[model samples]
Target: MEPVKFNYEYSRKIRVGFIGCGAHAFRNVYPTFDYAPVDLVAVCDLNQERADIYKKRFGAEKAYTDYKEMLKREDLDAVFVVLNFDRNGHPLYPKIVPDILKAGIPAWIEKPVAYTAKEAEDLVELEEKTGQFVLVSNKRYFYPSFEKAKLILESDPFGKPVSVSGRYPLTLSPFQEELGKRTNLHWFLDICHPMSGIHYLMGEVKEMCFIEHQPSGNVQTLLSFKSGAVGNLELPSTQADTSPFERYEIIGNKQNVLIDNGMRLSYYKGSKGSGEYGKAPSYIGDDPTDGPVHWEPEFSLGQIYNKNLFLQGMVQSVNHFSNAVLNGRKIERATLKDSLHLTKIFEAYKNNRSGKWITIE
Candidate 1:
């Protein structure tokens, strides 16, 4: 791994303006600037007090009650938006990002970029027209475990991933009336975390079928990937909050990889039986090198990896956008195009009932 540079160590930094002085921004996004190449020049929010507080707290040069005024006055290379849902429970990104694009400033916005795929399509069109890109902050794609998993999947040993299983504690309202309204989809929109990781690891879903449980409202979604792999997504809504909430496994040819609780990963490369199946002396295999490879964070050390900012991928995603803006690199992760795919999944769940195979295209 390359050594990480602190913000001051960079030879240059992008002039960044921030919109939305919310709690998530304060806790997750703003702290990332300490490690990213960002010079936070200005902040904006509808709440004047919050904006002023954020500017002072985060070391921004100026604060504004209106984001448009900030864009108008500040010479910014990129902007970070971390807005919350409006009263209607709809994300504010699709409504706001077009104006930022028109201003010729790249944007890094928090996800569920839009309530529908159509809104995402509009953003894609606007990005093409304005020549400014938007990177949705879907941090699941940047998670350290998933990053390592990608390398393992691409290696020669783990040949042809054939199936996937994922679990996340997210509840979906089964009623068609509730699904139709974005206001009612707050939980579904904000809490659908596993889909992004699944997309990153397994590629796009060609078709999907889901079955809902009655009292619990839990769901199990079956996916057929365009790559010819199959998948099962388990959204066990009634799972206890205190319990380990998420787990994932990708099965390849005679080899399988598992991610537990989004942090621990185990790769079970094809293991040979101890001697023969009937009369084995021990369960342990003969070759030490053939044992399953395992990885988990060491909490004792005061290292960057242990920090939630790095662990949960907030800093990595921020650095990715900042570097892309600074170097004019084409962003491969969490692009608007990726957002379109995720939005299609959202639309599929909302529009169709359980047990039906919905085609995604």
Candidate 2:
């Protein structure tokens, strides 16, 4: 059967059902429905009280304590699963995604899609068999600054990406043998952050080598992309609580771009001022406009740009998914293939030893 095509001008809103009513969904996901072309029909959660409260608050027509019952009764166009982790710190996406696909509806799942590579492969196979879409919500790829980076990298002005550097506050796990009983949950959860950025900027990784520091649990991974680009990822676990969480740099032949905290961006096309080492009166450039162009949202105004959903890329990603489902266009970012690549990175840390290079297929 052919996919449904929505009328861009006046088609009714696509009916969406949500599976998890957690704090994340309440703050980020449900709020986005107001801006997107979505009609939230139903919501499901393990806790009946929370489900009922979300249904009333978010305008969901029905709420159910059991997700299976909600899927059975509602003819939903799509489902969003923002569930928590299992006992092993594994995300519950692998267990729930298949059920959503079997119901003949597309789904958008929150990331760290799975704990292992095999689980991700299983989801990929299910997608192929059902011909249904499943998008992992990797919000960093959808951020405005990152989107601008994508354009710069793809455009002729930047030539080609030669190297990348990313900084994120993350904790590294112990060696695989010792990870069996470790209480460190950050390794499993935080791998997705840098992985999403790497996948978005550098494409799939061809090979990677990593080194971990024991005292601070800090890690640094060196990556080689399929495009022959090189990357360094640093996860510093001791960052200040009030400081921004991430920073990324993409270096090309004559151009370089930097994105700070997912919102601020700067592009350096070429060297601006040239002077002798000691003869230069000051390090300052010729004028205010001669060097790289910078972009950042103004925080003074009460606007969507200042909000976490918009600044962090959640809103755009959710909107894109809804539009694709409504308009019959294929999803461009956060595709199932992208999720598989991310899961591979997650598994690399889980199963492979530190300082070893793992190749992703």
Candidate 3:
């Protein structure tokens, strides 16, 4: 594990201005600054009361109702945007981030970077013109479980990753035309959590086909990756509320890795089962090296790894942006390009029908 540096221990810090003081930011985004190298200079929201409260609660220097005013007054190294969606279920980032980029400030915007691929493409154009970058908060790229899985997949023991599967909870409208309406896109946009993870591990998807089971509206989407690996993503809407929310598996030549409930990880190495299939005396194998390796955090300890903020990748994601701003480190993940791929997948769903393959450009 890499050593973690607290905010005060860093030699340099990025002076950051925060936009939006909503419930999500209040709960997840702002608190990550405690573990990251950030100097909170200002916060902005349409509601002055919430902005002021967040400023005081998060130890920022100032608060403003207008982000443009905050941008004019503060010499910020970067900005964090975590706004809620509009009434139409469209994310507010695409409309808000161009101004921050125009101010020559790099931004870390929460996901659903846009409602459509065209909107994401517009942001890409602005990024090139202004020479300012935006890192979309696709936390799965930073999640430790996926990170370790990535390393294992690249190791010689795992061979080639041939296929992948994931299960997540999502509800879709029964009407085919409803898929394209911005009003119905909230759940689809939010489902990017698993989509981002699959894209990160499998690379770009070339084509996809989804079948929906209604009136429950459960869905299963089949994916064909550009790397030639195939994938299946299950969005079963009938799971119990108390059930484990997500699971993912990546299969190699003979071995496979599994992530259960987004926390526990098990890697099966295709070891021989005891002696013979039915003649084995014990199910446990004799060779220690061939056994499956497993890992999960111990809840008994008061460790950073045990915390949801770290486990879910919020701390590392924030740290990456801060380091990129302060140390001039290049962002290799969660780029606008990644957002483009995600949005393209969104478009695939929006424009295509069930059981028909849609090609992603």
Candidate 4:
């Protein structure tokens, strides 16, 4: 297959400013500008020295120690906020996003939008008032495999989705108070990683029942979607050290899909013919395409597919955001409304007790 083409000159280059100069942005975010329609004009961080270093490294023209000052001086079309969490592990996006919106600039914030549901909702309300866009960087939904899964679910080939199973190694505390205290911190920080894919594959969840295993600090959640599809989430924190971090499977009427370790993908459309007891001449003779469509990048070549943008879903996500801002198009995924739903899910896991079902609708 040919590499997907992205037109870097799609629109008049957007004058972009960055708010965080942390390691993640340095490694994953700023490098994406190479393929996107962005003119990085300025960057700001609390540390002037680090900001200056990024400005020089990423070819930005200006750098500042304060975001407010940078916003006032720079003529920016958009800003990317990759700031770290507070002492409580609560993401600082809610506090910074309002200021960016008030400054009349669209913003793309890193995941786990805020520490609490209320904080997330506040940002939603602010977007409505300011008429500016604020998107969370939920990269899993931007992945090619998950993107294909979404299209398959919507297409008639899969009929209708019946159920889904997601596996992620995340630690959950059984104690209610401990969970609440950790709500805005470690728990919410990672929930967006899996929940983003869930909301994208299946629409808004209507109700959910979860059971927590105390001994191993694992959680099993059963979710019923508004589309009458049921799903399960397995958050096992006790997996082997060498195992991958995540896995997912979605079952439909006649077809099923699985994404393993965020890279390998398989689609099972059922067997073509029944096999004999012992005289099956060729097991591969059933069907050519229906067998299993597997996908994983070959790292032999120095290609963009091997880069973090393609692997971490950063390129497509940033491209999508840029296109929406440039063309006045509505975003299909990672909108504020989607973030709101995800925030509620994180809160439910934090506040609700095991075996107590919660309604998110």
Candidate 5:
């Protein structure tokens, strides 16, 4: 991939439209334009007051309560959508996205991409029919630390990536199936983080097994990958809110890398030689290549890497979709395809109980 270019450095900027003037877009998405190659032409939301506020705050020229009207009136290269749950606990994007594509504009939508794999498949089919693609902005997969982890896993020093593991704070009750997808919405949506990360890092999952804790509703899943790699996913709803919410590790042949809370990264190159654990004079390696190389953000500085927009991957995801639209290339990150895979993982959890190995075909 090419080094990223700042907004000012782009010779021509894409004229873009935005939907959803919610807390998430306000805090994360809208602020990313300072680093992305786009000129916001309009903002749209169901609430005209909120839409007008976003338009003024973000320097967009116009605002509208109806996105359909916005799409019809504005000549846009692409649209960025950030709406979350609907009244029924459904995601609004799937309902609105086909309309956007029907209008001939490409889109970048936030996850959860759809309520199930079937819905995602429908969206993909519409995307192909309209000749317009949608990028889901899965967020976690675009994190700088996690992006580098993918690179490391694909390289030689690690031999081959054999397994991956991730942890998140989420509650999924077995009775969610009884309540169906809408009432158990958060469980279906939040699983996107771990599922997207694993799919992006290790390729497709072939099959998986799960077990849940009765008290906390925490669940652990074991995944076998099509690539011959395996993975573990932990959903610990009782985990402390004071600490970081997510962590990950991938074990390569004789090496492994760990990521904590999307910031700290550690690459453990196994001990230089398999000597007795207690007999070594010093743990320091004789060669720098024998590495447990590490990385983490330094908040004291004003670096871009330290900002939440960068650290959480909002800016990077925006820039990526913008570049794809501007360059006439298909967007790969968080594509409808990735969303489909993630929805399958969601379905597996909803459909199966402890000890069942559900194959993802």
Candidate 6:
């Protein structure tokens, strides 16, 4: 589908309610309303003061301390759910999402989806039963650079992706022995960034073999995808603070694409060359299409792409969910499949017993 220009004044907006008036929403989710086609109808939070503040700040007509109360009182097309962690480092969505579905309201939620794969699977069952759609806010999958790379890989010349590699700067908390006291909770939160992009590009992981760094507990994992593609995830806990947080590359035969710092993308349009490698004159390519194509947003301009909404993918993601509801379309970008895949990977880390190979069923 072709991209539609956002115009709140000219276009109709979806009547939506928001839950969790917290810092994350204030910084990332709520600001996107300026560009998205959404009419903020109500705001809900545990704190009446925070809910009222958010209502006034974001143009919501009503404020409710109870989301169930908000759902009952307001006629909403969809709801945006953003909340902090629980005592177990698990997000509240696993419990709250079912309520939204039961009330016949669709949701756009943030990660991590749940503490375990079982919880995500249970949510999926509820989603299927309720027939209410959920669009997860996995922003990395919507990043402009990665989106372009995905298009390049899917088309000709690139063919099918055969292998993948991702580098993210994060640490695994020390392994805990207590059962169900998973020490990889923070890892689950951080892995969402890289896994969102990888799962969007590659299909799913069949299983993985992980290795660890002694002192820092940093890990490097080899992920085997069900699509027969292999991948490596490099988690560098000791990486310098000033260094870029992410680097990714995927190979498809001779064609490949590389993403740097989540901002720059280099797509190599590889094909059979005209001349021999050693016998060729200059290394410069005569064919423009066969060479590498690069893309990165220009920050100097006062453009929407320059802002965090577009830059960090918060805007496009919200726009995507809003478009699904407004256009009466099926939402596919952020689904329960991603939640399941990510949970399996998180579990794999928790099950990193001696760095041996582990199959994710």
For model 1, the stretches where C-alpha displacement exceeds 4 angstroms are 1-3, 177-183
CA displacement after TM-score superposition, residue 41 of candidate 4 (Å)? 0.8
Query: Considering summed lDDT, which 10 consecutive residues are worst modelled in model 1?
Result: 174-183
**Cα-based lDDT at residue 339, candidate 1:** 86
Query: Candidate 6: misplaced stretches above 4 Å?
Result: 1-4, 177-184, 270-281
- Over 4 Å off, model 2: 1-11, 176-187, 274-290
Which candidate wins on lDDT?
Answer: 1
Model 2, residue 328: displacement in angstroms? 1.9
TM-score for each predicted model, relative to the true structure: 0.97, 0.91, 0.96, 0.93, 0.94, 0.93
- 1-361 in candidate 6: lDDT tens per residue? 2253655663688899999999989999998888788889999999999998999998889999988888888999999999998877778899899989999888999988887889999988888898888888888778888788888888877889999999997777655666633474554476877888898888788889988776686888899999999999998989998999899999997888999999999987644445786887656577756688788888887888888778778888888888888888768787877777788788777755646888878
Q: Give one digit per residue, the lDDT tens place, for model 3 in 278-337.
A: 797766667767888999999998888898889999888888877888877657789999
**Predictions ranked by TM-score, top down?**
1, 3, 5, 6, 4, 2
TM-score of model number 2: 0.91
Relative to the true structure, how large is the alpha-carbon lDDT of every model? 0.88, 0.83, 0.87, 0.82, 0.85, 0.83
- Tell me the spans in candidate 4 whose CA falls farther than 4 Å from its real position: 1-11, 177-188, 275-285
Residue 138's lDDT in candidate 3:
91
At residue 223, candidate 5 shows an lDDT of 90
- Clashing residue pairs in candidate 5 are none
| Ranking of all predicted structures according to lDDT, beginning with the best and ending with the worst | 1, 3, 5, 6, 2, 4
What digit string (tens of lDDT, one per residue) describes model 5 on residues 211-302?
88875788888999999998899888998889897988999888898989878989898565435777766666667577688998888987
Q: Is candidate 4 or candidate 6 better by lDDT?
A: 6
Worst lDDT window (10 residues) for model 3?
174-183
Residues 1-361 of candidate 2: C-alpha lDDT, one tens digit per residue: 0122322433567898999989988888888776677888999998999999999998999999888888999889899989888877778999999999988888988887887778888988998898888889888888888888888899987888999999998886676565543345545576787789878988999988888888787888999999999999988888898998889999997789999987889998655356787777655566746568899999899876687877778778887888888887668888888888887876676666687788987
Shift of residue 118 alpha carbon in model 4, Å:
1.2
